[model samples]
Target chain A: MRYAMVIDTLKCVGCSDCVVACQTENDVPVGYCRDWITETVDGSYPNVVLELKSERCNHCENAPCVRCCPTGASHIIDGGIVLVTPNECIGCGACIESCPYDARYSHPEGGYVDKCTFCNHRLEKGQLPACVSVCPTNCMYFGDLDNPNSKVSRLLKNRKYKTLAPEAGTKPQVYYLI
Target chain B: MQEEIFVSGRDIPNIDPSLEIWHWPIGLYLFLGGLAAGIILFASIVVILNKEDEYPTTVKYASIIPPIALVIGLIALIYDLKNPLYSWQLYTTIRIESPMSWGAWVLLIVTPLSFLWVFSYFSELFPTWDLKFEWLKKFEQFVKKNRKNMAYLLVPLSIILGVYTGILLSAFNARPLWNNAILGPLFLTSGLSTGAAAIILLAKTAQERHLFGKVDLALIIIELGLIIHMLMGMYAGSEVQLEAMRLLVGGEFTVLFFGFVVILGLIIPGILEALEIKGYKVPVAIPALLVLIGGLIFRFVMVEAGQITRYLY
Candidate 1:
């Protein structure tokens, strides 16, 4: 089954509680991030529009990081959870550079690339990703995209959404509904 | 009402410098690797043309460069990694699609082959200079026997190494400045130009020096074309791509890009080499020196500028 993340940009209010939860759950080091926010201002003068964008790994179907990794450290596994095998990571930074979203970080202590993993550690326990669970706005949704009955599939059927850098040909699984 | 959307990484409104993921070590590694590859490529061609004996400085000096440069480059690369110890894993598995994989294999192949190429030169140079060690003699004999096959092997691998220097960056879709298709050929030409300039500086024979001077001039002209093509392509790209090009054209690195890389690296050196080719007197060493410095500065600027940019704000 193909897993997906749907973020409702209209509902997000720039709160970074998800970021905090992600850091704490993963034991991420200070001054580094596995996922972060992108706050952008569009329009001008009286009609300005500001967007709080929580950006992270897209887990693209055609992942460039997977292609450019010399070793098998960066790989896509079941349900399309793109992950880094820390023990095997040579810390070459190829996967980090290959990501268009700037979603991956070179872990300071581990010397390997790290990014949002759908909280796979939590997923195995049949739980929501840390970000989705902590998001106070209820703006984040996760489900198996291949399952027509899943919430994510219903949301896509009901709304318009877009993916980042579609021209990159990565086919990102994350969707943002405005 | 008018509308505009701008992307900036000004994360947390920080006045402090943003965190850098890769630094000088990676830049230095790319520079040194490119320089060594350029030399090996040119030297392999010389040997294939049966001009090795005629251009002793080009053969001897050039052969030694790859081993030294590749060793230092590999060290810098490992040192840049967060876990330097895990680099050993690069050898056990190969991902054919990854430029880094190609890089790992290229280094493994070219390093030892280049060392033996140097030893092959030792057999030729030692007897004439009347200097010899027993093991060197024996090693040189083996190298001489296999030299032809080795040169054939080095020629393509050196080209791969040279192009890979740029491919390593271009493979990264995250950094728009480096993601251009022209980067591969542009870097290869730059490597060749600087490689020829380096040989010109060390060649003892006037004929060998003049030949390399001409070669360097041609490479510089081609490099100029490639650089322009790369810039123009980026300027026509998406908003983010245009912003990336601005870093080189009108941003922090503008002076370094237009002033150093364009004028000193290509223009001045190109004029000097042209004059010398026309039978006019001009010191080759100065332009050769500038080209080397320019080659280094180009890599440094590209690496740093690429890192300063991001896809989100």
Candidate 2:
């Protein structure tokens, strides 16, 4: 099943709970995060539009990171989640440079590139991703996109959505509903 | 009319405003690797042309460069690796689509070949030195006999290694500055130019110096043309591509790119070499040195600036 995350920019409060949840759940270093909040303001003087998004790895269908990784460290797994094998990674950072989303980061301790795994370890135990489960506003939706009845599929089918860097042709699994 | 972006909890180093994944060491690796590839390419050409006796620097003396340069370059590369101990994993599998994988494999094959190429010429270089073992002496004979065939192998592999330097950068589609296809030929041409310059620097005969001076001048012209062509393509590309070009043309890297790489590296050397070719009393070392330095600065600028140009905020 192709897993996907649908974030509602209109509902997100820019609270950054997902950022903290991801860090605590994944044991991400203090200065690093698997997901974060982004606020974009567009317009002039009196007219303005602000869009807040919780951004992370898109787990793209045509992931450049997976393709560019020399040692096969960055790869896609079941459900389209991109994961890094820390032991296999030579810490070359090629995948980091290839990612359009700037999702991956070089782990300082292990010397391997690391990024969001959709909380795959938790997913195996039938738990929602940390970011989604802890998001106070419930703006984040995660489920199988392959199942038409899933929350992600319903959101995409019913609402207007967009993906980050669509021009990159990565076919990112992460979707944002505005 | 304007757009402002702000992010909270995005304090991720090297990924917040822009990426700073690659640093000086990567630039150094690319430079030395390209230099080694160029030396091997030219050395192979000199061997294939049967000019070993006339151009000892190009064929014999220069033969010593690739092995040493590659070893040092690899050292720089390994040092830059976050997990340098895992560097051996590069040989486990061959990812055809990955330029780095291609480079790793090519280096594995070419490094030893470069050492062997140098070893085959040891007797001529040092008459007093002797291979005491029969097997070692026989292997040397085999290498000596197949020197031309080795050149044939080296010619294509060196070209691959040369182009791979650029291809490695270009393969990263996420970085607009490095995504262009021209980088392959551009880097290859620059490598060849630097290679020619190195030969000129080491050449003892006026004939060899003048011949390579002319060759370096030609390569410099082509490299200039490619640079202009690359900028033109970037100018006509998407918004991000324009921003990427601005990093070189009018942004922070402008001085480094135009001053060191363009003017000092190409134009001055081109002019000096041209004057030298025209029978003017010019020191060949001056232009050769400039070309080499320019080549190195070009790589540094590309790596540093390319990392700053990204698809996202």
Candidate 3:
């Protein structure tokens, strides 16, 4: 079954609880964020709307990062999660550049490129991702997208959704309810 | 709210003050790889065109330099990696879609082929003790045949390596500045020019060899045309791409773009070539040196400029 996350922007108060939770859980380095929010201001200051997008690895069906990795360091797991094998990575940074979402980064100490692995360890234990579990507003939803009865699948069917950078043709597993 | 927008989860911020390690090494690797590929291409052309006899010293030195440069370039690339030990995995696992993977494969195959080619070309310089062993004779004959094939095979391979360097950057569609389709051709053309200039300078001074005047003149003209096309293509592209032209022409990279790439790399070399064609004696070393410098600077400016301009708002 395909796994996916649906974020509700209306409910998201631009709180970064998700970012903090992911970092603390994964032991991600400082300054280099695995998940973060980007704020865009539309129109002039007086008439502006602050658009906040929490970005991370899209876990694309046709991931360019996977395609650009020379040593097969970047791979898609059985559950459609894009993961990096640190031991096989030569730190070429080609995958980092190829990712359209700008989701990846070169690890400071390791030097190998890294991104969110959908909290694979947690998934194996049948636990929700840190971001999903900690989100106070109940804005983030994660479940089996392929299972018709799953929360994410039902939400996708009921709500109008949009994927980031649709032009990239990456078939991102992350969907957003605008 | 302000704290959340840009706050670190860990008490200590993870700012790597130094830019990524891959930056310098990758740049050096691309430059040297292009140079080596160009040199090999130039030498093969001379051999195939039956002009090697006239420029024996040039072909000899050119062939020798590529293997050395290839070794250096490969080392620089591997040294910058986070896990240097894992570099050997590149050879074992082959991925066709990745340009980096393709480069690793190319380098592996080309390194030994290049050595064999150069060794066979200079076999006469080594003392030949004919061993009566049939197997040894057969091995020698096989090497000789392989060398001939290498000479012919490397022409396309060199072009591929040269162009692949440009394609590496162009593959990044998010970076509109580097996504131009013309990058491949422009890189291939510049590689040839730089490669030719390097050989010409080295052969004339280091090896005391002279090239056929007509051939030198012809190459210069072709190189000039390619540079013009490359510049024109960049200028005519989208505003984001035109930013590259601006950086070169009136922007921060002006000195490097006009002073080094255009004037020293193309203009001076073109003028000297013209003078030679006009029956005027011009020192070949001067123009050749300028050409080599120009090529190096072109790569430096292009790479630096591409990185500095960011569209991320």
- Native-to-model Cα distance after best TM-score fit, residue B38 in candidate 2, in Å: 1.2
Q: Is candidate 1 or candidate 3 better by lDDT?
A: 1
**Which one wins on TM-score?**
2
Q: What overall lDDT, based on C-alpha atoms, would model 3 receive against the true structure?
A: 0.74
How far residue B174's Cα lies from its native spot in candidate 1, in Å, is 2.2
How is the predicted docking of candidate 3 categorized under the CAPRI scheme?
acceptable
DockQ of the two-chain complex in candidate 3: 0.42
lDDT of 2 by residue, A76-101 (tens): 89999999999999999898899888
Better of 1 and 3 by DockQ: 1
Using DockQ as the measure, the top candidate is: 2
Tens digit of per-residue lDDT, candidate 2, span B138-192: 9889999999999999999999999999999999999999999999999999988
What is residue A108's positional error in candidate 3, in angstroms?
2.6
What is each candidate's DockQ, to 2 decimals? 0.50, 0.70, 0.42
Judged by DockQ cut-offs, the docking class of candidate 1 is medium
Q: How does each model score on TM-score?
A: 0.93, 0.98, 0.86
- Please give the lDDT score at residue B61 for candidate 3: 64
